[model samples]
Target: MVDRDIVGGNWIEVPAGKYKKNARTLSHCQLEFNCLYSDLISHAAEGDYSKMAPFRVLSFDIECAGRKGHFPEANHDPVIQIANLVSLQGEDQPFVRNVMTLKSCAPIVGVDVMSFEAEREVLLAWR
Candidate 1:
């Protein structure tokens, strides 16, 4: 038995034009239009032609200081910096670029550098 409430399960092909027309009329549904939109794109794609949805990607890096000649341990090492870069799916440049440093740091061009006096402050800002 298949659960009809689920967005996907058994495959059934519907014409793109008909699907779009009926999908637009769906309102106050448990599933939002955005979810249906994604489903439609995935289900309606043809050979060598697919709609590319715009999405954002957030990439982050954490810097930690460790003891000499040893790998940084979570309990022992302190996080010195948290760097973040956010960009669109196909964009070459990241629109949001920022870093939260534990202490003083030199200014960087095209990047927002936030230096906090305390480690807690940096962690809070990153959060």
Candidate 2:
């Protein structure tokens, strides 16, 4: 849904026009108005923004969690760490950048896959 109104959102609330909510974050957004726009996404996850002429850009780092140091036999999660965005951005890139680190790295909740124990002694007896 295209929600332009942010009521009691712990942020500013302007009259409804057009806006997009930031992925993985609440109350953060990119406002849509004059400049240039694409109706293609029409309210989806992406908004191609090169609205200005003479696209001279400076790319800040892009952050994401990805797999690295794969050891086939070992069952382990990938190196879950912040990697150098500079290498990822490429040597020719204008700015030296890496994934952004926010002071408030919001709590991320993983899917619940837990089995509750039965009444007292049910689990204890099994052990």
Candidate 3:
């Protein structure tokens, strides 16, 4: 099967902008047809009303302390020891005993790409 998927839009790249998000990537019209939007549509077709609900989801890049330090003069050693995933639900627990590192991601709950924001962690629609 051939996948005819494409993402991008026509917007002029600006230079020397005061705004933090000062970059041109995609247009407003084009943004409406993103993969996430398509997933919602597919859910609607399947009569899944839960997809119509609004929820708070955030994606973030954490500045980890272990590897890739500042400056070219600094060493970029691979990090083997790193603290991870502390859920805020109850005192922030850590994964312990029989620790396993996932080599590849198994399908979460669907085949429609990753419904997650990259990390499996989500606040959930009702969690």
Better of 1 and 3 by lDDT: 1
Cα error, residue 60 of model 2, in Å, equals 12
Q: How far off is residue 106 in model 2, in Å?
A: 24
Residue 3 Cα positional deviation in candidate 3, in Å, after optimal superposition: 14
Model 3 TM-score (2 dp): 0.18
Better of 2 and 3 by TM-score: 2
The residue-level lDDT of candidate 3 at 11 comes to 20
lDDT of 3 by residue, 1-127 (tens): 0122222321222233322442565544323222322222111222443323332232232222243455322144322111123233333343221111112234433222222332213222102
For residues 4-120, write the lDDT of model 2, one tens digit per residue.
322231233233444554445443233433321332122222243322223344433223233466442223332222313222232455333332232224333331122223222
Q: Model 2 has how many clashing residue pairs?
A: 0
The CA-based lDDT of model 1 is what?
Answer: 0.72
Relative to the unseen true structure, what is the C-alpha lDDT of residue 113 in candidate 3, on a scale of 0 to 100?
A: 20
**Deviation from truth (RMSD, Å), model 1:** 8.8
lDDT of 1 by residue, 16-103 (tens): 5433333564565433323242233223344433444567898999998879999999789989999999999999999999999988
Weakest ten-residue segment in model 2 by summed lDDT:
111-120
TM-score of each: 0.58, 0.19, 0.18
Clash count, candidate 3: 0
